[model samples]
Target: MNMFLINFSMLWSFSFFFIFIYIITIFSIIIYIIPSLKNTINYTKFKKNSNFDYLTGFDLYFLLLTPLILFLILNFSWSSYTISAWFGNIIFSSFQYKIFFFIFFFYSLILTAYCSSFYFHSKEIYDYTITIFNFFFWILFLFSSNTLFTVTFFIEILSTLIFLMLATSTFSTTYFYNNLNLNLHNYFNPTTPFFFIQMLMYFFWISLISSLNLFFFLILFYLKFLTFDWFIFEFIFYFLTSTFTLKDIFFSLFIWFNLLFSIFLKCGLVPFYFWKPIFFKGIPLHALFFYICFFYFFIFLFFIYFLLIYMNEIFFFFLIINLSLLIIGIFILLFIICEAFYLKAFLAISSIINTLFVFLALNSTNFTDFIFF
Candidate 1:
C-alpha cells in the first residue's frame, strides 16, 4: 500500500509543468522553425501566414481540457484508492472536486467555442492566447494541492501575480501591434500600476502568512511539543494544533487581522475601496475578463472556506463586519450601477459585486451547509 501511494498531486503538477515546456517547444517549432522548414523545402507555395496561423492557438482548448480530464482522473477511484492527507473532506478524489471541474469544464468548452473569435483578431492578438492558456495550467494545480493549505494559497497568490503580469504583457503587445504608446508623455493609464499594486498585496499576504506559519511552527518545534492529538484550524489550517492560550489568541488575532485586511484590499470592499475604481479605469474588456474570472475564482474558494470555518462560531464579531461590508458596498455600488455613467465604473461595480456577495453569503449563513447553497 505504501508502494502504491505515490504523491499524485506532485505527479500531476510536474506533468503539467512538463506539458507547458512541451507546449512552448511546439510553439517554438511552429513560430520560428516552421518558417525555416518551409523556406528550405520550397513550400512557399502555401500562403505566407498559413504555417503560423495553423498552430498559433490550436492547443488552447486542449490546455483547458487537460485539467478537466485530470480532475476526472483524480476522482475516478482507481483501485478504490483514495486521496489521503487532505485537510478537509474534499480532496482531488472528492465529489466536490468533480463538481468544481465540471463547472470549469463547461466554462472552458464555452471559451473553446469562442476561439473562432480569436481567428477574427489580428495575428498578434490571436497569438497571445498562449499566455491565457498557460495561466490556467498553474491555476489548475491549486486544485492539486495536498495536505497543507499553504501550497494552494501560495500558488494562488503567485498565479494571481502572473495573471496580472500576463495581462500587462497582453496590453503592451496590443499597443505594439496598433502602434500605440502609453507612456507618461502620451497617456497615463491603470494597466501597469494595477498589476503592480496587486502583486504587492499578494507579497504582503505571503510574507505575513509565512511569518505566522513560521512563528507557530517554531513554537511547536522548540516547546518539545508532541501531538496534542488535537487540532483546530482558524484559517487555512495553519495553526496545526490546539491553541487557546492568551498569547496564542493574541497571535492568532494578529494573523487574522492582517490576512483579512489584505483580503479586504483585494476584494475592494468599503473603507479600503479607493484603489479598485482607479484600477478598472481605461482597462481593455479582455483584460477585465481575465481579472473577473481569475480573481473571483480565488475569492469564491476563500468565501466557501470561511463560511465552513466560521459558521459555528459562538461570537458574532465577523458576522457584523461582513454585514457592514455587504450593506455599505452594495449601497455605494447601487449609485454606481444606476448612474449609467462610465463603462469602467460599471465594470468596477460589477466586479466588486462578487466580493460583496461573498460578504452577504458569509453574513447570511449560520451553518456550513448554507455555504454550499
Candidate 2:
C-alpha cells in the first residue's frame, strides 16, 4: 500500500509537470499572436498586400521543444530509478523503462515526420496549433495513464483532438480550392462539406459508442470492487474468480465482452472498421499519418497490456475471438485488394490487416513468435 501511494504520488507530480509545460506553451503562443494580430490590423488599415505569417519561427521552436522536454523528463525519471535500485528493492517499481524507451523512439519519429511534411507543404496556423496540442495530449495519455478511468478519459480527449485536426484540415483545403478556383472533383469526391460532415458524424458516433461501452464496464467494475487502479483491480478479480459461481462466471464474461468490444472499436477491427477508411480519406496526409502511426499504435499497446493482465482467465474467450479475427481479416483483405483504389483507402485497409495480424500474433505461446508476426 505504501509503495502504491509512492508510485501514485510520483505519477501525479509528473502529470502536473506536463500540464504546466502545456499551459506555458499556450500562453507563449498567445503572446506571439498578439503582435501578429496588431501587424495584421496595421496591414489592413494601410491596404498593404503583405502576408502576415501566423506560424512564425517562435511557434516552430516551441513545437520542437516539447519532445525534448518529454525526453529529458523520461530520462530523469529512469535515471532516478536506476540510481536508487538495490538487490531486491526499487524506488520506482511502477515505472516501466522499456515503455518509456519505446515511447521516446516513436515520438521522435513522429516529430521528425511532422516537421518534414510541414516544411515542404503549405501551412495553416490553426493546423499547427492543433497539432501541437494533439502532441501534448498524447504525451499526457502515454505517461499519466494508471487507472481504467484515466485511460478512458485520455482516449476521449485524443478522439476529440483528432476530430478537430481532421475538420480543420478539410476546411482549409476546401477554402484553398475555392480561392484558387480549382476543380475539387479532381482531388476529392462528393464535395468537401458533405463528405467532411459525413466523416465527422461517423467518427463521432463510433467514438461515442466505444466510450459508452468502456464506461459501462468501468462503472460495473467499480461497483463490484470499489477501486479503479489497474493492479488492485487485477488482484481483486483473480481473488473473486477463484470462488465464482457459474452465474458469476457468465456475468464476468459479459463484462469482459463489453470491454473487449470497446477495444476492438477503438482499434478499428473488423465489424467496427467501416468508419476508418472514410475517416482517413477526408484528413490531410500528415494528420492521417499521425492517426495511423501514433494513435492506433498507442491503442494497440494499451490493448496488449490489458490482455496480458487477464490472459489466464480469459484465454478460451480470447482464442475464439482470435480465430474469428483471422477468418474475417483474410476475407476483408481480399475484398479490399479488389475494391480499394484511393491511396488513403488502401492505406486504411492495409492498417486494419496489419492490426489483425498483430492481434493474431498475441495467440502465440512464444515471445519470439509474437514478435515474428
List candidate 1 stretches off by more than 4 Å.
Answer: 1-77, 84-91, 119-128, 146-153, 156-231, 234-247, 267-271, 309-320, 323-340, 365-373
Q: What is candidate 1's lDDT per residue for 158-226, written digit by digit as tens?
A: 445544443454444443333234322234334544433453465356445544654454355334323
Q: List the candidates' TM-scores in order.
A: 0.60, 0.73
Give the runs in model 2 whose Cα sits over 4 Å from its true position: 1-52, 56-63, 70-101, 119-124, 174-194, 232-241, 309-318, 332-338, 365-373
Top lDDT model: 2
Q: What's the CA RMSD for each of the models?
A: 7.6, 6.5
TM-score winner: 2
TM-score of candidate 1 against the unseen true structure: 0.60
